[model samples]
Target: MNTAGEHMISEIVGYISELVPIHVDKTKTELSSIMTKYHVTKVENEDVHPDLTEKIQLFLSSKRLEGLAERTLDGYAMELRIFADHVKKKADNITSADIRVFLGNFPNLKMSTVGKKLFALKSFFGWLAGEELIKRDPTAKLKPPKTEKRLPKALTIEELELLRESCKTVRERAFIEVFYATGCRLSEIQKLNVSDINFQSMSCKVIGKGNKEREVYLSFKALFHLKKYLQSRNDDCEALFVTQRKPYRRLTGRGIQREVKNISRNCGLEDKVHVHVLRHTFATLTLNQGADIVAIQEILGHSDPSTTQRYARITEERKREQHKKYLVL
Candidate 1:
């Protein structure tokens, strides 16, 4: 949503965000009460058209389109409200200048945060243009700011060896191998079912972002651990990965992150060993072994080559060693 409406709408948003356990379907009366309490209505009286709210609700509920996730739909609504305030209240027609004004205020924002807002505006205006709601797109000219090309943290070969050697449970080994083999996002991996695995080919079929399906290969060691884990699985449950706890639902991203951290700590590894690190490790190692960068991009299911190029960059150790050989400094 646009910046002005944000203050009023956010005050009206349920105390706990919808991303958390808080209920998102609060009454307009409840929203008005919140606005009154916060005195946000006084400052932003023209913000968030009530008709636009109904339209957004209808759009989110329709399964024929994207934006299904509850958290995502909520965020989109908030973003649209912000945009509507900025656009509809404009004295003159909205243009790239208005968009520039919105983006220009984010100098103090973190790169990730700035990226999200830009993405929100882009999507909102794109939707408006698609529906013929707008004659022209204000966000059409917006550009994502270039974020620093910091390499993802990955375990060194020795650190990986140490961690792999430290694993006493077959479950731990399976988690590590699956992460490295698939390079799937944590959310994708968490949602994997037993049917997603190809036992004969030793590959995993993952539902990636945008609901795209991609196949990722497994190593011999990865397959070994997976097979071992499968032997202990309950036939009644279809989940590829399950916790030891009762009710036996899917494992969460947080659960996997904690497991990786515990394993890293136990093995005395210095690097932070999260799931994304495992994916980066796979990409880096594969690129180092002469695998094509484009192939790595496909394997990791990245739509952009620029995203994969970060993996193609040399490691710090390699750069330091190269400087030693030059001896000019």
Candidate 2:
């Protein structure tokens, strides 16, 4: 029998079973026999359009060709894949209402997370419209959630000193020093080659987001620890930092994070210490020391001066505290 015929028979059997109060065993046997004879199949939604998949590939290729970092490309791909799966439709067929519904479903997510997802969708749909693949951008009407402004956390000078002292190995000390000195992103530091650093000048070239290269300087203390670390290494991996094991591979971002956490715990720090906090510490300290915002922007590889201005705000807060203590009214 066809699917409709089989479905009708199952419904009839279900009503009969409920009405007659037949034994469960007999009902199961009868249902099994009917299913075997009819060969009923599970229903599934239609597959997403081939054009949608093709467009996604093209978008990724464009990002690669535009010199986006690998990690950034991976994020874009993952975000778009999730959005596509949630919608389960072609890009052109997606509607603003559908996107609103999808985003609304993620109620438990942080505002920043929801904003990131919305930004990804907006970028993807914008690209589709630009390429003329879609008549209208579905995400055009969507607005990202407003996230609360939180100050970046920076370690105190004493805490930094204690953290550095807690490092038992030359490698760990060097890792912490470089992170605090350069203010580079975790991925930028992880991708650093040995040749990128200049010991005499106390500076290194880092590839920031969009594969943009910038120079970041190191402090005398950072240079000293880094030199010590390098002198202790026996491998020829060419990476600035490597694992301690044999065949020493380059250290990954996660490895560096774990090392930082271990050092933080050893130092008895109650607050979390990660690569980004180290960066915030660098920027905050530099601003307090009277470094110009533009110079901080260059050191931190921030494309926008406004991003570097957060440290200036920190400085203002410090000044306000000092004024409160010193003013005699």
Candidate 3:
């Protein structure tokens, strides 16, 4: 083989070794033999331009224009960059087998991580196909890895009371109460403006994922605590939740997580506590009190009923356990 062809074969062997967990020498020898048999001249397609990164940027731009959340756009960019790095080929030149190998290489990744990566790649390739950038979609037949269906962890009423008791400041108390009462996602609560709350109606509008707005009702106790917290704040910032210090800024998701973690530690709860747990507690408690699943779905701003159905699963499991323990049979 010519020097250029030999160089291409070596590069192909190295890439295959990275993807397959095989020894470099063995992969090189095997690939060299296969190349010799097939008269392979090049690894990457000669006609394909090296513009995968540029194409990805364009795709992300389209997503931004479509009003995708910045976080979601960031995820797509990161995942696609990882895929491009692994495959080391032009977007249009990537094959289904190559995509499968790239994903399979990350055997240690969480199922959710794998699923997110697959979704990004599938979307990218589907877009490319739609735009006639590629002859076929590489991810058309690809399936995301199945994630385990673990039930949402929710704090019991007694544990919640303990958490409330652990809070020495109004801010912490009000934050926990709002989480339990509204069942809002951490991002939703953090993005809340002070003007969003309607004290008379005891409800607040939360901007949820995809910038969808929904009303989350506040309990009487929650309303009282929120009023107290707001009264204590001296900042002119419009954010409902803000840092306690001077020059107060809106609380971030991480800030709320830290607050919840500290409160859980102070309360001495055994299980790990976080904002989502409080949201789960709200849903489970509401369902146990006979709230309709459809109503819960709407309040939670769930675009799909199946996502809301998980709370119903938790309620059903509790009923089964109670039956087993209390029945005289």
**Best of the candidates, TM-score:** 2
How well does model 1 score by local distance difference test?
0.73
Q: What clash pairs does model 2 have?
A: none
Q: What is the TM-score of each candidate against the true structure?
A: 0.71, 0.82, 0.80
**What are the Cα lDDT values of the candidates?**
0.73, 0.85, 0.85
Runs off by more than 4 Å, candidate 2: 1-46, 315-329
lDDT by residue for model 2 (1-329), tens: 56665665667677887888877567656766766666544333555555667888999999899998888789889888887777777778889998989888899999999899899888888998998989999888887899998878898888889998999999899999999989988999999998999888889898898788899999999999999999998889999989888879999889888888888889887366877999999998988876888989998988998888877655567788878989999
- Candidate 1 — which residues are off by over 4 angstroms? 1-47, 58-107, 268-271, 315-329
Q: How displaced is residue 237 in candidate 1, in Å?
A: 1.3
Candidate 1: clashing residue pairs, number: 4
TM-score of 1: 0.71
Can you write out model 3's per-residue Cα lDDT over 1-329, one digit (the tens) per residue?
46665787787877877787878877767667766755444446433344787788888888888778888888898888788778777777889999889889988989998898889999999988898888899899998888998888887788889999999899999999999999999888988999999989999888788877899999999999999999998789999999877788998889888888888889787356888998888888888766899999999999999888888744566788778989997
Q: Name the runs in model 3 displaced over 4 angstroms.
A: 1-50, 314-329
Reference-based TM-score, model 3: 0.80
